[model samples]
Target: MSSAAYERIRNNPKFDKLVATRSRFAWTLSAVVLILYYGFMAVVAFNPTLLASPLGEGRIATIGWPIAALMMLLFWVMTGLYVHRANGKFDEINAELIKEATKEAQ
Candidate 1:
């Protein structure tokens, strides 16, 4: 195995810290989203009748429809949050690592 590159970055405290923090946030966020989604689905599954009933008069929507819509919205928001963090923070770290590696090679 060649160790010509990444030697300095491997020992960089900043890079290691950034990676640890990013990984922690990424995993925690993913778990929270999964738990929420499954929990909601489980609730609906156990109580199928809850969504079947209409919220109010004929004009009102079904209870389940709104809940599903809210879940979708929440998922979309979570996706956006993940993208924002990945692009802003994670990618920045990656770019720095690459820049330092290339500089060291030259």
Candidate 2:
């Protein structure tokens, strides 16, 4: 594509909205993952015994095991959500913006 096409897309308000929306969403997801990871670390640092304890009266597993597993699962779910949005809403807006830019350039 020509620079003119790129310039038209950049000047479009929808382009701005798409960038803002996508950045906000990505940042939000990043923050959630950071919090989860750091919070777990904090607990492990300040209270080792809590996480080190057994899962139940007779179980060999520790409480931290399931928590760590769930955290990983949640991270995967968050990733999937981002991919879904990027492929669905973000891609749709991007395609529309490109189409508009191409038309204007012609």
Candidate 3:
């Protein structure tokens, strides 16, 4: 059987490279964020006092609000990072693929 879908996609080296790059980046970012967020939660869970104390207070600005704000900020930052990379790099790859496919079809 012919693998038209696979072949069509694989024929474009840039497409594969782009996909791999995006996948790697996404995985790495996810792991980092997951580790940081979950690690914080785990520490907090284990030692509630640590997160609630003045010195060991989870966040800088006021403990509770600060921690919440920090988490929101971090999540937004990650989202922005992903959007930037996807638009700058992945979109280029996608455009090239579409152009090539259209050309081939014509």
Candidate achieving the largest TM-score:
2
**Per-candidate local distance difference test:** 0.82, 0.95, 0.77
Candidate number with greatest lDDT: 2
In model 2, the runs with Cα more than 4 Å from the true position are none
Alpha-carbon shift of residue 34 in model 2 (angstroms): 0.9
Which is superior by lDDT, 1 or 3?
1
Query: Which lDDT tens digits does candidate 3 get at residues 15-92?
Result: 779889999999998998898788888867886765665534464543655675788799789989999999997998
What tens digits encode model 1's per-residue C-alpha lDDT throughout 29-63? 88988998898788788988877889888855778
lDDT computed for candidate 3: 0.77
Off by over 4 Å in 1: 57-60
Residue 32 in candidate 2, Cα distance off native in Å: 0.6
Candidate 2 per-residue lDDT, tens place, 1-106, comes to 5899999999999999999999999999999999989999999999988998999998889999999999999999999999999999999999999999998766
- Displacement of residue 105 (Cα, Å) in model 2 is 1.0
